[model samples]
Target chain A: MPEPLPDEGPPSDLVSDVFARDCTSRSAFEDVTAKWASLTLLALHEGGYRFNALRRRVEGVSEKMLSQTLQALERDGFLTREVVTAIPPRVEYALTPLGQRVAGRLRALADLLEEAAPEVERAREEHPGRAR
Target chain B: MPEPLPDEGPPSDLVSDVFARDCTSRSAFEDVTAKWASLTLLALHEGGYRFNALRRRVEGVSEKMLSQTLQALERDGFLTREVVTAIPPRVEYALTPLGQRVAGRLRALADLLEEAAPEVERAREEHPGRAR
Candidate 1:
């Protein structure tokens, strides 16, 4: 008898290719790297936090945007949203293992940017036309 | 004189903080990670490319979008633009040292996502309500 068919797997050709115009990976890349998403992931990297605490730590995210950002990250498997029964029905957000990995890498990038901030500012000064 | 007043450095407090809502680095982070910008940086990471070639390589970017993205990257000191004196005044774009550093990190994140694509798709399948 023929060997049992392999269980369901992502299509053999389903390689994530951001270079491809129609690749779904492009959307994944965007979801992961969007401004708020990156900040949210970094914020959660430290530890789980209640929604309001997360909002405060993330600095500028409004209530609606934070809610949407967390939901999107959770949907992408980068985070988990756990609701605990209590007086206020507390909600905590934390990174999944996958999210931790991404967040680690993002932190490295963020560190590099911080270290190079002085240089970047100088570049802006030199190119006044591009300064925001 | 006392150390010549340390010759014009970025303000001591001018740190790049993506977590800060009002931080200018927030703008820089956005410029770096925007969809087309990320893809464009990855495309140029391989090597320099002419205007039309770059537009093609980045896959889905419109001509105007590519131009604007390239300008933003150039202004950020992450890349440079050169206009060759030719019959058609050929233009080229390439990553600067700073850009190379960023591209390297971004590439790692991109690779991680590609490797995790199977899992992410699985998550979407399990959470049909969130599937886009």
Candidate 2:
């Protein structure tokens, strides 16, 4: 058998382990890049919005998933949520500056992806073996 | 209670649903950013590596998770795994050209993240409320 790979799992006590070996960065990347998360972050980063406005801006997102995504992002400190104690209890969500920074990076990635997506499609069409 | 966010879920028959809502993208993001996956992809993207070489390059990853990530990436058509019939069964892993493209985007993101990480830290330190 071949030799085993080095094993540096995430530090158990570090919250940022998500970015570390065994934590959730993998998952986080998946999350942040998702259609809704990306669009939502983009929308919010453009300007703070209330919950419904976010839904409208994102086009297609379920209440459960959006709530879940927002909660996760909030937990990760990517966005901030402020609940206004009103008769109807209004809540506003916006990117933290940290979130804004990440969103900027993600937006750049998205732009690049969008530009390359057509080429990727052509490549896949030309060489089926290159893509699934 | 406030009106809930809209409930647009994933399309039932879409393959790239990972990039859509209500699919594995959230989970996938969580996975890709996970320490091993990122490093592994980075290491592999730099060149190519065998299973053992990848293990060493990534630092810390369990055999199972690595296998899972490889399989997932392969299914998504990111990396290609080649098995050369040999004593003890030798397998090599390399990024597909498509993978190379994605990795380039990811690397750009990683670089941006690395640069912004310090700024984020300083911001958090300056304003405790901004971070978790």
Candidate 3:
């Protein structure tokens, strides 16, 4: 055979261009590190939930923003939305398997980020009059 | 004395509240992960540079956006901008020590991300026509 037909799309060069600014990893960077996305990913990974439940659990998310965020996540394939046939028509969102794995890793990073709080605080104070 | 008054301002619970979305780290999240900020930080960490030099090195950075990115980084204390009171007013920017440490860590992460590109690509291919 001719090189086994080279499976899948060409490999991503996220690493090579990751620090280069114009690299493809920028998309991943933007997605994973956005304000509420990682946290939202964590919540969805737990199980399926309705819109109201996510709003309540996410803390400080406006309905408009939550809906927008969910749409973005769903677009990225990190989440799957299902609509149940009911009187009012219920909709629920949950993590796909890939999202689950990514969320698990992100959750661990979140834990580390939590532990780094004291250091970040000190850094902040050390530079008091700084900050943008 | 009173233990030096515990140094300065209130301790930031960034790590603890990181997953909460409304936490202070949200600011950090917004700053660090923006499209060109990380790459800009990397370039700055290399050494001080005038505005145009950075634009040239970074590739695809608009002058307005570069200025904005620099201002944000300066505000975060990750960069220090010094204006030379000369004929054309030369201003050069460089990393503060703390910024160097952060850039170092982020650079490592970028490298890991680059390395993981193949896997991410594989995941994408496996999912086929997925991705948001």
Candidate 4:
């Protein structure tokens, strides 16, 4: 068998291990990777948006899901919620520097997948069990 | 307010829309971003691994979860499952080129979060409701 890659496993040098169940990073990472959460972060990457506007930008997210996602992203310091004093108080969400960085990485991943999706669709049609 | 980002909202330029609820890419992206699924892909990026060996590499995943993750990834054409006929059939899992590309993106994301975990931890400590 070929030799395993040099970075086969995470080097112990890093202080945090995301694969570890108890790592606090896992909590924040999950909140970011959660479907709605990542999409919300990406939406905010564009610019600030009021809650309903963000829902529209995200395409199909419901009010409650987007609300919870924003709260989680806010708690992780990925985004900020600012309430503008207005007729009913306009609440806008935008990415913080950390959130911007996170969104950048997510955007890259999303871009890659979106480009490869057609190939993946073809793969699905050929999937062995698809005929079963 | 600063001019909104030119790239705001998916640009309407990509061939596929990952944010759209019915998009095929959404299904594949969700599978990849799922916690255990992502960790498994990362582990295989090192090289091929048998089922139990992979379980150990991922640290905290249960066998059932790992099995399901592998199936999802395989179905999406991100990996290949091989059965080596030995005294007892040995099953090995490895990433296809597509899987490799996916893992590369995931590792970048994972590395970023790993580096940022301490900051996130500090944020968690300061989360508004932590005092409640």
Best by DockQ: 1
User: What fraction of the reference structure's interface contacts does model 3 contain?
Assistant: 0.21
Candidate 2 per-residue lDDT, tens place, A32-103, comes to 665467667767768899998888766578888798778767765678889989999999998987788778
True contacts kept of 2: 0.06
Which candidate gets the maximum TM-score versus the true structure? 1
The candidates' DockQ values read: 0.61, 0.09, 0.23, 0.51
Writing each residue's lDDT as its tens digit, candidate 1 over A2-102 gives 98757886448656787765665666788888768898998899999999899899887789998888878888888998889999788889999999999
lDDT per residue as tens, model 2, B1-132: 998756787444444322344434433443444445656677787897898778766656788878877776665556778898999888999998767766776776565555444444444355444343
- Docking class for model 4 is medium
Q: Which of the two, 3 or 4, has more TM-score?
A: 4
lDDT for each residue of candidate 3 in B27-108, tens digit (9 for 90 to 100): 5545655667867877876788898998888778889999888877666566788889999899899987766765765565
Worst 10 residues of 3 chain B by lDDT: B12-21
How does residue B44 of candidate 1 score in lDDT?
Answer: 87
Model 1 has an lDDT value of: 0.83
Report the lDDT tens digits of candidate 4 across residue range B1-132.
898868666664556877887887777888898878878888888899999999998888888999888888898899999999999989999999999999998788778888888788677678885421
lDDT of 4 at A102: 89
lDDT tens per residue, model 3, A100-121? 7667665554444455555555
Query: Residue A39's C-alpha lDDT in candidate 3?
Result: 65
**What's the i-RMS of each model?**
1.6, 6.6, 3.9, 1.5
lDDT of each: 0.83, 0.63, 0.67, 0.83
**Worst ten in a row by lDDT for model 1 chain A:** A18-27
What ordering of candidates by lDDT runs from best to worst?
Answer: 4, 1, 3, 2
Which of 1 and 2 is the better model by lDDT? 1
State TM-scores per candidate: 0.88, 0.58, 0.60, 0.85
